[model samples]
Every structure is written in C-alpha cells, then in structure tokens.
Target: MRVRPFAVALMTAALTPATLMSCKPSSPPADGAQPPAADAGPSSTQTDTAFAALSKRFLDEGLALNPVSATQIGEHRHDSEIDDLSEAGRNKAIAWNKAMLAELGKLDIQALSRENQVDALIMRNNLEGSLWDSETMQSWAWDPQVYSGLAGGAIYNLMAREFAPMPERLKSATARMEKLPALLAQARENLDPARVPKTHAETVAKQNKGVLSLIDTFITPNAGQLTGEDRKRMDAAIETTRKAVEEHQQWLDGTLVPNAKGEFRIGAERYDQKLKFSLNSSLSRAEIKQRAEAELKRVREEMYKVAQTVLKDKPGAPELPDAPTPDQQQKAIEAALELAYADKPGREEVVDFAKHTLDVATKFTHEKDLVTVPDDPVKIILMPEFQRGVSVAYCDSPGPLDKGLDTYYAISPIPEDWTDTQVYSFLREYNKRLIHVLTIHEAMPGHYLEGVHSSKFPSTLRAVLRSGVFAEGWAVYTERMMADAGYMDNDPLFRLMQLKFYARAVANAILDQGLHVDNWTKEQAMDLMVKQTFQQEREAEGKWVRAQLSSGQLATYFVGAQEHFDTRKAWEAKLGDKFDLKQYHDKVLSYGAPPVRFVRQLMLQEPIQ
Candidate 1:
C-alpha cells in the first residue's frame, strides 16, 4: 500500500502474524470489538494526561529500538544508527514492549477522551502485536527478507529524502553505512538456513546486491558534496559497505538459497493469526473467503453486462446472451477486455502514460468535487530496484513527520531481459484504462491524497501507526467510486477495467488464503488469476510470487474496501438526505489512517476501545 522505505515492507514481511492476547493492561479489546461506554468509568482529565504521556514515551522508546523505522517515520535523531538484529537486541525490544504494555495497563480507558481511547487501544495492539510476533511467531529465525529490508533501509532512508541538508544527510549515511556490515553479520547469525523459505532466500539473494546499487545511486553521487575528512570517511565507509554487501550476497546464494527448505506457506493457524493482526477487523478467514467469492461472482456478472456493450455486434464476438452460461460469460468478458488491452501504452510509455492519467484523474476529482485534492507534490518515478519483483507500483508518501515533501508514485519499469512477448503481456495487463484506475488508486484521490489528509491531523502517534487496511481499502474503493461517477466520460472500457481491478482485489483475498491455508498449487493460482480475474500472464505470474512472499497483505484491499463501503453506507443510512459525499470523505480521512472499524465507530459516536 505504502512503500516509502523498503524497511517497513521487510519488517512487516517478517513479523506479519500478530495475535492480541490479554495483556497486563486492562485488556484492550481486539479490533472491532465493543468497548465499555464512554461514561461508565470514573471521569477524569488526569487519566487522559497520563495515557498521552505514556503514548509519547512508548513511541520515543520504540523508535530508539528500531532506528530504521524511526528514519522512515521522519525521526532523524537515529539516522546514523541501524537496528540491532542480534538476539540480545531482539530480547531487549521484547522487554521494552512488555514494560510498555504494563504501563498501558495502568490507564483507565473510559476516563480518557474518546480520541485518546482510540490511541490507547492502537498502542496496546501495537505493543501486544510486537510481542506476539517476536515471542509467538518467532519470524526472526526464519525470514531473511526482514533483515534485507533493514540492511538496505539504513542508508536508503537518509538518501531518499531531503529532510536534512545534503552534507548532514551524507554524514548520517556514512555512519549508517559503517554500521551496516555488523547488521548484515547479525542477520547471517540470526537466520536459520533450514528455516528460510526458498522463495524468500532467492528474492533476497537478488535484492541483497541492490544495496550496493543504492549506494551507487544515492550515496556515490553525493560523496563529492562533502570535503576533507568527512568525504574521506564517507569514501572509506562506502568501500567497506560494498565489500560487506558482496560477502552477504555470496552467503545468500551459496548458503541461504541452497539450504532454504522452509515452507513459504505459513499454514492455517499462522495465517488466521496474521489476518487478525494485519487486518485488525472482525472478518475471519471464512467470512473473507465467503464475501470474496460472492463479490467475485457479482462483479463478473456486472462485467458481462459491460462486455455486451463493448462487444455488441463486433465481428468474432462471443455470444452475449442475457442469461449467459459460465463459458459464454467468460468468453464475453475476455473478448471485451481484449478491446481495452488493444489501447495499452508501449513498454517505454507506461510511466509517461501514468503521469498523464494522474493529471486527468486530479482534474476530474476537482471538477466533480470529489474529496478535496491536496496540492502536495507527487512525482511518478521508477520503482527502486530493491523493491521491484513485488507489486507493479506503490505510493511512497513522505513520512508523516516530514511535512511538505514529495510523494513518489513509483512504477516498476519493464525488465530489460524480458522478451517482447513478456513486455507486451505486461503492457496489456496495465493498459490505458487500467492505468487510469491505478492513478486513481495510487495518486490522485487514493494514497497520496489520503496521506496528505492523514498528516494534517496533529497526532504524531496516529500517523506513526497508520493502518494498511484503511489506506489500501480507500484506494480500491476509489477506483469503483470514480468509475460509477462517470470518470473518463462514462467510458464502459474504463468501468470494465475498474471492475477487473476490483475483481483482482477480491481474488487477492481468495488467492492469499488459498495459497497459505488451503494448499493451493501454482496451477490453481494461475487459473484464478488468469482465467477468473482476467489478468495478463505476466501479472498473474508476478502475483503468484507476491502471494508466496507475503501473506495477509494481498487481502487488505478487499477487506479494507468492504469496511469502507459499510462505513459509508452506515453514515448514509444515519444522515439520510443530509449525507454529502465530499463531506463524508473529508471527515473519514480526517481521523488519520486508523482501521476502518475504528474510523466508523468514531464517526458514528460508537464507543471506541
């Protein structure tokens, strides 16, 4: 959803499964669970003050424990340091989490303001989730991508942004670079080759070397910006770090990959737990699958109707009967989509086309008076090499702490080694209409706009713990919202692409559970992506890899969108004719990026726990 620093991605990749058990703190309710009435407990301003202080302390200490995360969140105080990945370092973090959980337990939730109650609950979930990840999941012993993200992000964070002057940032970069080898050494020490999933190992094997490329891209060019001793030290650090990265690459290939025999699938129990934490929703695995399956059918039926419009009377068109059989429905949808695919950009023109789409989507959002469009600068750039091989594009907004910096709408370039066939497949998948849908999801009224609104809230704590479900959900929701509102002049092709994209999100929910919990084979996954969702071969293939590399993430779009849709419907029901679209949107985003459930509760004056 958001991938500014690959570090967050890596951290989440490793520590994805989280279970919120009873903590020392007065057991904060799990996400979406009802809390005590606001006026039930002793009313006191003192509890609010205490909890606020505790919240700040937790963030400060927690950031100190993971310097890379601190940097990504725009806390530059730890810019020169890398995370301590050693066993002792991890134990120290666990202890810190326990201590904080204990402190949080002493607070009175009902006594605090409603806003503070939400923050308190989020803090508790965060603390308990960290413990569950470290103590229960023990991902550190298995996941190599976790360490890779940290190892690369140490320098990437400093160089990616201009939060500080060039010389200052370079000095920080040098300090982190100097410390990187030991961090990599710690990763090597911590990872168990037998426990490392082969896919993860292979992915990191390719990515580990990308750290050097990062230095070349971000650090080497700026080395001349320094002088004398500082420049000399940076040069020395760069050389040492390069050797370290090379050695790490050797280890990853020669040792890790060959010995990586661990299962990529986290299995049913772990998948369920991770779904709970990652989604922070009431929806269970079964509920998600059921809803996703139903949506898949309903959306396809709608697409078939659109197909009839696009394919009506065309030569070689599939039969579009009013009540078509399954085979006919599939044929009709595919034939109509071929028309959309015919209008795709060339391999070299994807980024340029995306830029144009952003402008057009922005103008539409403003003209239609959709949610207020922020003036925050957004740049369309190539996806960084270390972060490639996953999803096609990600919105990398500035860290909430970093005020008015640029939001990078990063699209991965078509790989050079790929044949013309592969490139064409990729282009057809990301055709002109789909690109407009993507622009709506990632930049104009999606992540970039939501991020701007989220940062406007004064609470740093909320910004630091923004929910992926809410963010990703809003993006997917917008694609349909824009299409239904007649974006692109009520173009049926655009609507079809939008529905197809939504279907992919629905399929993502099913695919994730299928692969992780249901023992789905590659063939089964391909069938779902290519045949059912109407994805291009290249897109399906990449998603298969993405599904294995990360669990619970692919489903966030569908789960989040469902919640957003429900929340909007609830408000519409309550307000009746008084409900205004722009106002509802502005207010929904105003609460920072909390889970949609919490946002709903807050908006509806329900008890937030």
Candidate 2:
C-alpha cells in the first residue's frame, strides 16, 4: 500500500516546531486585534492542505469498507468485524471505489507537490484495480482462497501479534469467530461450484482445516484468562467455529471438489488486465516474457559456468560443456548443486539455520555497506499451519502502523508424513546456501528491511498500497546483489545457488504464464523446472500446484527484478561516478514501496505515468 500525503503532512506538522511556527502569526496583531484574517486565497500551502484532506478522507473511508485490510495493517478499530461476503457487500465495495475514484479525479495533480502526485497516482491505481477485480474479474464468484484467507486471517491477525492486550484481542477474536459460520455460509452462497477451480478447492480445504490450529494453539490457551461468562462465550464460539471449518472442509471434499471443473486460467485478456494491475509496470506481458526468457537463458548459462567451477576436479563429473545441450546443462548444474545440497541442515535445524543466516547476512550487509541495516528486530519462527501449502517461506512484517514490532521470518517445516524422497527433495531445493539466499530475500535487505523503511514513510496510503513487484523484486534483487558483493567469500556453491534462485524467478514467470495462459501441462511445467532450473521433483511438483493455485503473482519476481535492475542502470548512467549503491537503495526505498515505474519517475524527476 502507498502512503497518504495527508498522514505525512500530519506527522510533519506534529513533529516539526518550525512548521508550526510558520503557520503562526509572524507578529502580534495589534495586541488583540484578530491575527489579520488568515490569507484565504489560493496558495502552495492551500494546495497541500486540499490534497491532504482529500487523501485522508479517501484512506479513512477506504479502510472502513475493507476492515480485514484495516486489521491486517494493525488498525484495531475494526478488529471484531468480518468483511461482508454477500452480494450486497460486493456491490457496496464497487460503489465505494467509484465514489473514491470520482473524488480523486477532482484533485489537481499538477498543483500538488511531487510526493503527493505519486501518492495520488498510487491511490488511483489501487482504486482502479479494486474496481476491476470486483466487476470484471469477479474473483468472489470463483476463488475460494478469498474466503478462506479472510476466515483464517480473521483469527490469525488477532492472535499472531500483541497489538492489544491478549484479553482484548481474544474478545475480538471471539466476536469474529462467532461470525465465522455465517462467513463460511456466505462463501458457499457466493462461490459458484461450476466456476471454482480444483486447485483452489483443495488449497482452501487445507486452509480451512488449518484454522482449527489457531483455536487449539492460540485461542484455547488464552481463553482461560477470561472471566466465566466471557470464557464460556469464547469457548462456545471456538467450538462453533471449529465445527463450521470442519463442515466447510467436508463440503470442499464432497461437494466442491467433485464440481470444480472450471479452468484456472483467467485467459489472456483478463491476465493482461490483472497483470498490469499486479505489476503496475510499463512493460507489457510479452515484454516481460521476453526479458524473462533471456534472463532464464543467461542465468542458466551462468549456472553452468559455476557448475564447471565446482565440479572441475571431480572424477566422472560431466565434462565442462562449451554451449552444452539443455540435458547436458541440467546434468552439469545438478552435479554442482549437489555440493550445496550435501551440506543440508537437519530437519529440526531449519529455523535455527535461518536465524544464523540472518545474522551472517546482516553482518555482511553492514560490513559491505549494502544498505543501512535497521535496528528493528526480526525473529525466525515456524509458519503457522493455515498459512502453509501456499509458499514455503515468507517475511511477515508488522503492519505499517505497528512500527518497531518484531517481523517474523517464517520457514515452513517439512510435513511429518512426507516420504523420504519428498523430504530429500525439500532439503535439496532449500540447500544450505539457498537458505542463506532465502534469508537475504525474506529478511535483512529483503521484505523485512524494506518493510521497516516503508513503515516510516509517513503516508498511510503508501504503506497500505505497497507494490508487490517492488517488494518481491527488491527481495529477488538482493539475492543477486549479495552474490555479486561476494558474500560467503564468493564461494562458487553460493553463487551457483544464487543463480539457481534467479532461474527459479525466471521459471516462476514462465510457469505462471505457461500454466495460466498457455495451458502447459504439469509434465511440461515440471520439465521446465527440473530440466531448466534444476529444481528437485518435489519442488517442481509443489510449484506446479502453486502455479495452478495462483496467477500473475509468479511473474512479479522477474518483472520487478528487471525493473530494479533497469532503474539502477539508468541511475548509474545519469549519475556516472556519483552513483552510490547504498545511496541509491536507500533513496529508492525511502519513497516506500511504490511501483518501480513510479520509483523511476520520482528518482529521475520524470512525469508520473
């Protein structure tokens, strides 16, 4: 989410005595005579005042409608309310967006400061995206993840943090839980079984079941703290919510799964629209695919060279190939990747390994002056069960309003029931060096670092309307940046692992488009992952499921990294020797997580697109 200029202005007004002084009377007005009726005519300050007022109203009203988002961002005002999942609710959101857009159109962008112009654009894009999602995309009609996420996040958000007293939060959780059954009922009423995709149904089923973990692990333990009446009510609500989740799971398995014959693909037309909204970039889908394809090849070739370095002395290692065939490249790359895979941490040590890696990455980041490391604390924790099966690792940053709070670097442990092969595949894919890369991407200079900087941007809208591309792109970019800086003494294994991640980024774009747009089969997708990117079978299979389960998101990594790379190159060209990597990074992130295109315009003083 982008920051709102009004919040920034308010913070400035509150903190800067000079700003307050400037607003006061320059001299006493005739010992009690009115301070000379304030200058009411149009002025630069008036423009800011007008925009700030509009920005705040827009944000405040917007948050009211999207209470789930409000809660996620650490705003407690609507913690007890569940999002309206009814048809009327959808219409209301659409109407609200329309009204906001109309109001935004009235703002004089040219009259506003550069920062406000950026804020206005971010707000406009967000509103437009929302309208598009509701009207054209109609995800509510087909996507079960929407409801499941709300269901799970409703309780998870309240329980995961100490944003409020535990009892207060528990009270809110009970309120939300009491409403859970109806929300699930609304999901059944709202979702079109004929339109629901099988992958979505399966994923949501898993998530719905996982919600019980929240009750068991967090809510149940804390319920004891409540007095008798409150405790009884809370217990009853939990029991009811658990039953609702179980019933939903049963429906998912019995009814939804059987009827989920719909295609997961949004097709090219919707994909293009949604992709534009998701990326907020000037590059077209074709352009992104072109860049990704090139990068894929380049990264693969680089991986081959690194493989050659790692395996040069090993007997029977595949001969160094000068322009090897795809099969030969895969063979060689896998051979070298084994060196990293051989050093895997025990299953129990994943979190500890990530913790140690965070320390090392931070130390190297500061020692090399990569970017200013914030003193903001970060902790490594197991990903909650409900959030599992979506992605293996994530950086769960505190809401922008929840500054200085601990950011969770969540690593999903291997499922206990997995077969030996599955376990091996998981470990090999996340090999020790790659875990370092993961730590760099999810913590240190990745999401956690960027999030900390974004929280201080002073604009609520900017923090709320954060660009996924910028966030994911910066994280992906850091993997390469760290590798380029010779972290781990420039070990070929680490560099190989870094390049593999780059390949995965490229593969992500390819897999997303290929599956959702090109209708690539699981075999074809797996071939690309295993053969081209050297992903293990289990990793490739999980990615296949993920690709089916999502769209456009996978492309963000490659597209965003390219934008970051291009922006850096342009800045370097413009500034010549004056360009500094650390300064550039700090400056880029200083604007919060606006789209890279906006960042480029701001950095270069170009017109906002």
Candidate 3:
C-alpha cells in the first residue's frame, strides 16, 4: 500500500508502444525461475561477505548502464550522459545481471550469521529475481513508472543539474539521438504487446506529450550549435526522432490507445513472486490483503480525529468531502494544500527553510531527547526536468558510492510557459495535505538528513537493497514524528491538517492496491480519500491515476513508519536511560534502507554486514 507521488521521473505525451523504455536494455529475468546451484563452501558469515561483494558488482553494472541513477546517487562519471539504446548495450546489461546472479547463487546463505545472512539472502534473491523480472515481467513495456521515469529522468537530469560541462551534455544528447531509432525498435520488439496494462498505455500517452515538448524547448536549439557534420548529424537525428515521436504518438492514439488491453493486477502467481523477491519474503497475497485492510482501518480512525482537529472550523465538513462537482472538488483540494503549507516558504525559499526546519526540529528533539539528528547538512534543489510532470516534491538521497555529495530535497517549479488555468490547476491539486505532509516526508528529520547517514552504511549489499518500505515508512513516520516533536508548536491546526494528509497517503496504499489487484471501485477509492482521508479533488484525482499505475507501493508509508516507531519504542524499553536519540537514529539508519524486518534484526544486536 506504499504509494508516493515521487520516486522516478515521468514523461508526458502519447507514445507508440514502439518507443518503449530508453535505458537499461538488460531485459527482465527469464521465466521467474532461478537455476539452482549447490550451496557455497564454508559457513554463513563467509557466504554473506561473498554475496555482498557480488551485489556491489551488480550495483556497479546498474550505474554503468543507467547513468541517471548514478547522478541521483551523486555519481558524476556519467552526469551528462544518456544511455545507449542499441541492442548491444541492452544485451550487455542483461548479461551482466545474469552473470552476477550466477556468481551470487553459488554462495551458501546457511553459513552466515543471522543478520548478515538475512541481508545476503535478500540481496541474492533481489538480484536473481530482478534479473528474472527484467526479461519475463517486461515491466518497462507498459509500466508508466518505468516509461515515465526513464523519460522524466532524461529531461530532469538535463535541466536540473549543472554537474557536467555543457559540451558533455551536448555530446550525450547527440549520442542519444543516434541511438533513437534502434532504441525505439528494440523497445517494440522486446515489449510484448499482450502484456501492457491498459492503465500503463493510457498514462504513457499523456506522459509522452510532455517528453516531446522537451525536444522543441531544449534539444533542438541546444544541439544546433555543434559544428560541421556533427551539427548535421545531431539536427538530422533530432528531426528523425521528432518525426518518429509524432508517429509514436499517432501509434498510441490510433493503435495501442484503442487496442490497449491490460489488467492492473499481476495475478496471484506473479504477485507472490514479487512479494518474494522485491519485498524479500514469502508474504502471500492474502496476508498482504489482510495487513492492508487492518492498517487501513487503524489509519482511518486516526484521520477522523485529525480532521476534527483541523477542519472543526468548516461547517459540517461531512467527515470526508469529495465534492460532486469537479470545480468544487478542485477548490477543496486547493484549500487543503493552502492549509498544509501554511508555514513553509515557496520553492525558491526552501533551502533556507530546510536548514531552518532541521534547526527547529533539532531544538525540540534535543530538548525532548527524541531521535538524534544526522550530522551532514542537506540542500534543496529545484526539481530537474527529468523528474517533472509528477509529484510536487521528493527527497533524493546521495549515492552509496559517491562522497561529499549533497542530498536534494527537490521542489519542482510550475512549468514556466503554462497558461493560468494550468497553473491554477496545479496549485489547486497540490493543496494542503500534499504540501505539508510532503514537507515532513522530504525534509527535516526525514529523507534529506536520514540519507546522509544511510549513504555511509558499512554493508554494500544493505545499501543496494534499500527498502522502499523503510524509506517511505521513515518519511511517513516523520509526518507524525514532527507533530509529536511540536512542529506547529504555535499552530496546532497545521499539525492536525498534516495528519489528515498523512492519513490520505496511508489510505492510498490500501486503496491503490485494492483497486488494482483486488477490484476496488473508483467510488470506493474516492470515498476513502475524501471522507476518511480528506484529500482535495485535484489531488485525489491525481492519486486515482497514480494508484492505477502503481500498486503495492502506498503501504510503505504506514508500514515502514509503524515499524520504525515500534522499533524506537522497543529500544526505549530495552535500554531505558541508555537509549540516546542520537545513538538510536544512527543505529536505525546504519544498515541502509533494508526491509523493516531486516532492520529489526539488525537492531536486535544482529550483524548487518
């Protein structure tokens, strides 16, 4: 149920299924089955060390092929690069993942200490299963996150960072152009037409439009500067892709658009496999459904109390208010955003605000002796073009391998040339819960500072298996954590309103997965957001679309937060006066973002590396 607006970048425009993903050609794993190997020689601890080194190699391959991921993690080697779309590059990555898996599978997990063994097994299964999913699941074929994120990263990296020189940027763009035709062709060939989710196809169409705009706005003029044959080559390449992109759009509108036949659910079989590999356990579908429903109810009661606290001023706020009219809904959403962000400064003012937020929170945390603050400072960057066309904001952590890199609390600006209607639509949608809860999620003792410590973890495998649950959980947990820390010490209303948004995200995880995988209706989903969670219309609508494209994600917020909170409570009971906040936080983040279960084990005096 963990759903968040931001993770990867997204594209805007219709696309022919032909123009599939632009990077990581390594196709998903072959058949969801792993080829068995004899257990490695020696004990569990030795095996864990071998597997950790193996996973590091896998991460290196990921960075080499997908440079944008590297840049996000603070790797500058490929800062101005776009990945090769040729079959050769894709095949190489695929081969690399496979080989890494083979080498890793040879290790014996039974020999390692419990904590190291847990991480080892998670890393091993993660790599092998991911390799399987890469080829078999065909996630990039229609998953909007895959498509949008790939394209979005391209745009954002080009626009957002000045990490590389202009020449390097232009060269990468030029090189990218040369690979476009082949890239599109391979995409079509590798992506099975039958597998795309109807939701994915539709989302991609809209996402593609935004991506196409980049060519006219950024690439054409930028690339036009190259001399001689290079200029001719780049321009011709651009023109060719431009025409192809139009055809791609036409294909989406005319063919895939009309013929898209996809189901949001992966069915019980694939879902189980995903639970095993992606989540690092054998959690059954029934188990997740049960867990989701239980959490849903618990979060709802919390939301109701929060709503009463914040919206008591609104006459008969109707518990949850999804306006029947779109306009009314949009207005409600707008009002919600305004309420949540009452204390924060605008995007341009956020860096200072980031520091100030930490200082303010640290003051209380120090006084109350809550969790300790991370030592490294973080900065807020304006959202890059690559990450545009999606959420309002996200906290981007530095890469595991990179040193002295800044953590980015990226805030996306409104599109500069948009019409007033569009601008207002965006603001209206981003209303209260969206902004306030996100601030707590992305800043303060949330992602930015947390990341600085996570990046320094000793376990390389632990770093790679950064749990989406823990990452999102910690962020969501912080929304409440701040309130408890007296975030709006002066204005309790702000704290209450923020809780409503946090609840909305909590509901999102349940409703998102329920709708996609369990046949929950839109009315049901909307009701949860409006009445139970208090989402504004525009934000709620966005959530609907986001939920369709995403499943098994929204739950990370509540689940991770709950686990984090529980762990802290346990530590306090165990250590009493010895449970220093600084030591506690440092300990929690020390194992990187492993699944909460693994983190729990690590916290119980278990060996992580």
Candidate 4:
C-alpha cells in the first residue's frame, strides 16, 4: 500500500498438478482399503470468478488502508485521508497483509486463467513483500525519509493532479495538512536514533524542510478560491503545517544528525530478500552479480572501441593497439567523451533542451512506427524542490486510474549553491546527446508511452502492483532500441552515448551489491563510476549518496534490461519473419508493467511460472 514513487530509472517455485480420479468404494475383501475419492475442485470459470472477486476485494481493502496510495493511483475515494504511521497503524497494515495472503492461499492456482494466475502471483508477492518490509526490513524505524516522504506526499498528491476541482483538492490538502504535525510526531517516535543511518537522517532533514516549499509552491496558490471560513481554516492549516515541518527539520538537524549511528548496509541476507521481492525474477543474487560483472566488462570494451573511433584523429591520441593498456583505453575514452561534453546546454537552457529533444524523439517514434504514442499529453517541468537530491530527472506519470491528466517529465535544475566545477561536471554528463537519451528513456517511448499503455490495461491489481523491473527495464531498453533504429541519424556519437548510459546501468548493479553487500568504500564506488563507467565526479558523488540511501533498486536497470532483451531474443527466434516491433511492443505493454518473465509468459502463451 506504499505510494511508490514514479521516478525514472528506477522469485520462483515449481508446482505439480494432481490428477483427480473417481474411485468406487471397495469392499473390505478388496485387494486394499478403498482410497477416498479425489475432489476435482472448482471449474476454471468458477476459480476465475472467485479470483476476480478476491482481487477486487484486495484492491479495495488495500486502498482503504493506504489512502496515500489511493491518491497516488488516482483513486479519489480516500484522497482526503492521511496514513497512520503510529504503531497501531503499522500493526493494522501487517494484519491486513496476513489476511489477504491467507485469502490468496485458498485460491487454486491451476484452475485460474493464465492472466488470473499472474494476478494471483502479483497479489501474493505484493502482500508478502509488504509484510516483509514492515516486519523484517523495518524502514519506518531506521529511515527518516519514509516519514518525511509520506508527510510531503500527503499534500503533494492531492495538489499535483487535477482529479478534482482546485477548491476540492485544496480542501483535501488542508485536511491532510492539518494532520501533518501528528504525522511528524509519529515519525519522531517511530525512528530509533540508534538504528537511523546517517545519510537517511541527513537527507530527511533537508527533505523535511523542503516540504514547506511544496506547500508554498503547490498549495498556497490555490487557496484563494476558498470562501471565508474555508480560507481561514486553510490558512491556519498551512501555517500549522509550516511550523510543524520547521520543527521537524530542527529536530532532524539538532537531534537525529548528532545521534544517527546505524549502518547503511542492510547486509547480504536482507539484500537478497528485498531484491527477490523487488525484481520478482528467477535470477539469483550471485547470478545477477555475475551477469552484471560480465556486462560491465563488455560495455567498457565497447566504449573503448568507440573512443578509438572518436580520438583516431585527435592530437596526442593513443595508438590503436590490438590490446591497449588500461591507461591508454581510459585516456582515449575521456578524450572522446570530451567532444560530447563540449556541446552541453547552459544551465538556464537545460529544461528547454529536454523539451526540444522530447519533440524530436516523439516525431521519430511516430515516423518509424515504434510503439503507439499515447494521445495523453506529457509536460516537461522543473523538478519540485522536495523531490531533488534523489536523481536528476524522473517521469511522473499520472495515476493509471486517472484519465486525461498530464504526465510530468520533471528535470531537476542545478542547485544555486553548487560550485562551478560541480555544475560543469553535471552539465557535461548530461550533455546534448545524453539529454536526448534521457528524453527517450523518461518520455517518448519510455515511461510516458509505457505508462499510457499501462493505464489502459484492464486489471486494477496489475496496474497497482506495477513491476519496477519492467518499467525501468523498458525505459533502458528503449534507449538502445532508438539508437539501433537510426535515431539521431544513427550517429555513432549518439550510439556511443547510449552505450555509456548502458554502462552506467551495468555499474548501478555493481555499485548496489558492492556498497551494501561487500562494504565498499565511497572511493571504490566512485572509481567504478568515474573510471570504469566514465561518469562525472559530481555524478559519482551523487550516486554514492544514492547508493547508500537505497539498495536492491539500482540493480533493476541492468537486471531488467537483460530480461527484456532475453525475452525479445526468444520472441524473435520463435516468430522469425512474423516478428514485428510494433506488435511485440504493444503486446508486451498491454499486460501492464508486470515483470518481464510474466510478460514473456503472457506474450508466448506459455505456462505461467
């Protein structure tokens, strides 16, 4: 029921079916005692109906408990309610998950349709995973961001979309704002200082303060429409919320910062569990690490070749040996990337440039018959202040349940306080062609297009239980797809940048495992990003912060992209000349953003795993 963030870049068993046979009661004199007759169980239609009902019931119950999630996915029935972060609230959530899981356990998997079977698995995984998060991982006790994010999003969700009138949304915002202090108080009570990680405490301190900015930017403007009494109440609520945020920020800075003593790493065991839940893939952690390491090596070599191509005519370029030394390879790669970096947008022009690239990418997708572009409009906006520090940009898709709302493609502006070197490094890393790649991922054929398709999917449970792997994997896959399909004139420079992005994706998995599981130092992670992946210093430093703040998530890009590629390869091999890109993309996306393996099952009409 967590309101999962719609940020850009963002498990298995076997069962046997028993054959049922009618048995006549044998006489006592028969060869053996008569066996009891087997029950054939429910018909497929009956099981499907039961499952359909159960899924609807689960969705309704879940949304009722987690109102913030309801608002996130465009379910307005509970839009005005705030989640209770108190111990009782947590217990209620745990109990709900247990109950739903028990209910799911009663359903017969084999009797359900293939689609229903997938939904059943999705429901079971979501419930089990949520329980694990609450009981085992216990982010509420250690991660201050959990509370601050909820507090901020409580208002942000209502105000960000136009699911209701301005007056009504503002009213809901006021009601949520009035509850802000209690939410923060519960946060303080729930977060144990001894278990609070330093990075989390620090980030939340900043984010708690930023919540006030969200209110100012999103809520205050709409308050003018209220009548006298409502206006008075709204103003008072806003003031109270601002004071509460400020007090929480003060506490985070003065108390939590000094006392936070927890380890950032969740350790190998927890990582494995969370990764399984997050990915829902068959690949084990060791296998993922192995594949990532292999991909990292292969991507680096590809970059080296592209570097050789770019620097072949440059002064002091290293000689192209059959086997260049590591130092030579590094030097040539840096020199070639310099050419791409030279064409970066100025600070003021970043968002505009992204807008321009989005238009171009959209045109290309349409002209080339890539996936069907949704008629739903997409907007490019600056990242709200509260959402910064996590990543540079994300695609904020409207709730799947909310039709005709604008999907925001938000780009974070460079901070005003950053040093010139930091700013330059950031801009260089997100240079012109790279910006185009970002557009392709966050907009066009990436999150925006896929998200639109996701909204049209028939199942509510599938929509709510979206697969991070498929969402991110599809976005990552589209980058390579566009490059291969002659985007940007099929220019090698663009292709080089695409490979560089892919390398970043590969290193993300490496960094996630390295830092959390292997206890890698920042220096080690930075080396992997800056030297091996060719990321900028500023980017690497930010990635280090992000790596500590999150785990099991960074690996999704590489792992998911590989799953997507593997699926495509199998499909192509199976279909041969019958294979069609548009058909394949449409078919895969039509199932909503389930894990690629499930998509594979559905696409090929294979047995459900």
* Per-residue alpha-carbon lDDT of candidate 3 for residues 189-219, written as tens digits (9 for 90 to 100): 5444566677778777776666567766667
- Error (Å) of candidate 2 at residue 28 is 32
Candidate 1 lDDT tens digits, 306-407: 999989989989898999999999999999999999997877777677888988998889999989877545777898765664456778766665655676
> 1 or 2, which is superior by lDDT?
1
Query: Which candidate ranks first by TM-score, i.e. highest?
Result: 1
Q: lDDT winner between 2 and 3, please give it.
A: 2
The top-ranked prediction according to lDDT is 1
Q: Alpha-carbon error at 296 in model 3, in Å?
A: 3.8
Alpha carbon RMSD to native, model 2: 7.5
lDDT of 4 at 546: 86
What does candidate 4's lDDT look like per residue over 247-333, in tens digits? 888888899999999999989999998887777887789999999999888877888888877777778876766598888778877
Alpha carbon lDDT of each predicted model: 0.80, 0.75, 0.56, 0.76
Candidates in descending lDDT order: 1, 4, 2, 3
lDDT of 3 at 338: 51
* lDDT of prediction 2: 0.75
TM-score of each: 0.92, 0.90, 0.76, 0.90
RMSD of 3: 7.8
Model 3 regions lying over 4 Å from their true place: 1-53, 60-99, 110-119, 140-159, 192-194, 215-233, 281-288, 303-369, 374-376, 384-392, 412-436, 606-609
